[model samples]
Target: MSAIQILDLSNNSLSGKIPTCMGSFSNLHVLDLQKNKLYGTIPGKFAKGSPLRTLNFNENELEGPIPRCLVNCTMLQVLDVGNNKVNDSFPCWLETLPELQVLVLHSNQFYSSVWVCSKTKHCFPKLKVFDLSNNRFGGPLPAWYFENLNAMKDVSEAGTELQYMGEGFHQDSITVTMKGFEFELVRIITAFTAIDFSNNYFYGEIPKVIGELDSLLYLNLSFNKVSSCIPSSLGNLSVLESLDLSSNKLVGKIPWQLTNLDFLGVLNLSENQLMGPIPRAPHFDTFGNTSYLGNLGLCRFPLSKECRSDETLQPPSKLEDDAKSSIGFGWKVVLIGYGCGMVFGLIMGYLVFSTGKPQWLIRIVEGEHRKKGRRPNKKRGGRRG
Candidate 1:
């Protein structure tokens, strides 16, 4: 009915195409048909000025491109069409929706690069959760889009009241891959933020701008063709919890700056061209050898590969070498002088004793006795008196 405001048929065995008329409702704020057997393209032609806020068609048998007509619903917030058969390019057009927050298009046939939309200055300004994994999206990481994720950069805590993300009537949720495990978050809080761009064809050096999102919680760029050294600027993410850059073409030593993230709990830099000793710290120490498994050049406690002494110790400078040589020569000279002194003393003693009381020794003793006789002991004189 047109009067219905919220329609939730998720996690059901409902089959057939989604009713086109449902998009016509003026008051419909939430439409959830996730985890269903629905088989058809999503209904296009959402009414202009429609108050629809949440549209979830995830894990369905849906096909065809995402309906562009739904852009008319200016008040839309959450759009999750993940784990479906939808085939389309990156939906850069959705940047028009100012109120859009969460966007999940993972496990879909979405292809092409997520190129910047020149028209929109502030794209997805309030987007907190962005999951585009398991798609055919290629090209370098979208630094343009990341630059405008103002919501993630600055999370507002204006109200003292705490609440999950959703219309008051229906609590919104989504499945996310975190720390190498799939987790179904039933209630997404306002502070929760994650960026999962893994399992894609994206290549090139990960943009350094990514470190600017200081408030980010989970970041996964794994299973891509991304190369280059991990940025040291990522240490700016003081509150970040999980970071996964595994199974990529990343090279160079793991940045020591990452050790500054005291809150980091999960770290996976495995299967890459990374070399050198892994950064050492109690936090990094907790991670097992598996974290640096595929990186043969990585060494330290987590890995059995010990760094060679030459690799760990620096070569001595010319000045240091000269100082060492001088010290060694000085010690050798002192030892030679000591040996000569000992030999001279021993030879003099043998000559004096072998003669069985030499005349020089007897004369010196007799002269000392005469001087002692002339100078009487003061204590002895006092006793006599």
Candidate 2:
């Protein structure tokens, strides 16, 4: 056992606490004990100058904080403690491991803010995958971590033989959420870059610097309290395939610039306060109403509501509509009365002229003529007398 370079006791029915002496091997390079029924805390000691490169304790019942002494394994490259009960803050000290590449602490009780050491000029310089989802971490999104991911920004070497993270007797696997679905990648490529900070309490706007990761393939910051408009600079990620910013407090129009992402296969901006017409593009047309649901202000194609043009008149408010209705009804009533009176007068004229002269009509005319003639005769006779 002392000369063994790899120890893989994973995917078994093994239970009970991990042996403290498991870390005593000086030449051990890989220690995998995932998918088991193990309980209790991890061993607190690792031999100095240990050659251990991979330590995987995924899908176990392990509790308590991670062993601080594991830092002794300066050559550690992969550390996965996902789907466990480990309760601790962000392990910023892991930044010291120069060879460390993959760090996954998902689905754990890990709480508090993720702090980055100010003095560490190059943190996780070679890291390719960083997942902290389903944890209790709360605070503003850590922009410093994104700023220091120098590895993610670099373009993979072209025309070279593709290399995987683990290519030996033991293969490495990780659960990645893509297009709102979880998939376990049985083999990880060296160029694969992803950052998942979902299902947390992170607030504030997404850092514009996130667009600098041109090599990123997947980026999920969903299910948080993130607010404000999404950075238009995100259009710079030409290679990003999956982008999820759902269930946030974000408010604003979807940046038309995002249509530039030709490679984007999955996009989720639902449950936000976005408004205005959804950007028009061939890529956007592929998405359905679910992508923009919960945003009542949003309108256009894919949604049933049509966007209003600037020249279109706005509908009247309730009070204004009621007043206009009352005024219109009053004018209609007056017009109806005038029309009825005119019709009755014309009917009386037709009876007198069209059907020969009527007695009542003739009598009214004769009486008016007699009164006028008598007035003139009376005046002349009085002057002669």
Best by TM-score: 1
State in Å the error of residue 136, model 1. 0.2
What TM-score fits each model?
0.79, 0.78
TM-score of candidate 1 versus the correct structure, residues matched by position:
0.79
Candidate 1 structure quality by residue, lDDT tens digits, 1-385: 8799999999989999988898888899999999999998999869789999899998998999988887898888899999999999987888888898889999989998887457466888888899999999999876676788888888455345677887477899899997667889888887788999999999998888888997799999999999999988898898899999999999987887788799998888999999877777678688888788798887767677789775664334447889999999999999999999999999879988788777887899999988888967899999999
Point out where model 1 deviates above 4 Å.
158-161, 313-385
Clashing pairs in 1: none
Count of clashes in candidate 2 = 0
